[model samples]
Target: MTVAVTLLLASLVVGLATGLLFRVWALALASPLVAVVSAIALQSAGFEFFAGVSVIVGCLVVSQLAYLLATFHLHREKHSMEDEVDGLPGKHRQKNIRDQYE
Candidate 1:
């Protein structure tokens, strides 16, 4: 029981961090599901409760960090793309294409 509770709390922390990193409130709301599954899987695998919690927390942190880094990279790529488009020879042509798409 204690192990279950610990795992659940750890998962909640992970979920909260993920939600914050992604700015997605829905992820935070779904944290309990993550916790429950993690607990079950860890128990089935014969890991102690604390160890399972530690592993879950570590995974969560790493995943959230990776997501944040990816988002940053994507934002940078988008900005660079926009700049490239802006520096093209024909501004009117770009505007026309944007308008057509819109």
Candidate 2:
């Protein structure tokens, strides 16, 4: 496949996997760099380097959009969970280890 097509596919897969399955913000954030590196590695000698760079840039933008969409859903889910937890009667509010005082 051409670098453009390959970059598109790779970025989409990585963005979706990291954003949906892993819900890892950092990884999702790094997907653009990953796409760029993949393009560099997989690009054909006949492919124009400037064209490959443009493809990578396009892929990066799409991946970031995908990541934002996924993270928006995650934030919604998290807020819903927190609301549910806060609705319990007689609850003192839940705290994680990070919130606990030593």
Candidate maximizing lDDT: 2
lDDT of 1: 0.59
Model 1: how far residue 88 lies from native, Å: 15
lDDT of 1 by residue, 1-102 (tens): 455455555655665456455555555544445656776777787888678888666545544555455556556634555457557635546687789899
Clashes of 1: 0
| lDDT (Cα atoms) of all candidates against the true structure | 0.59, 0.66
For candidate 2, lDDT tens digit of each residue in 2-80?
A: 6567677777767766677765567745774777576766575456778767777788777777776777777764555
Quote each prediction's TM-score. 0.45, 0.56
lDDT value for model 2: 0.66
For model 1, the superposed segments whose C-alpha errors exceed 4 Å read: 1-23, 29-32, 78-102
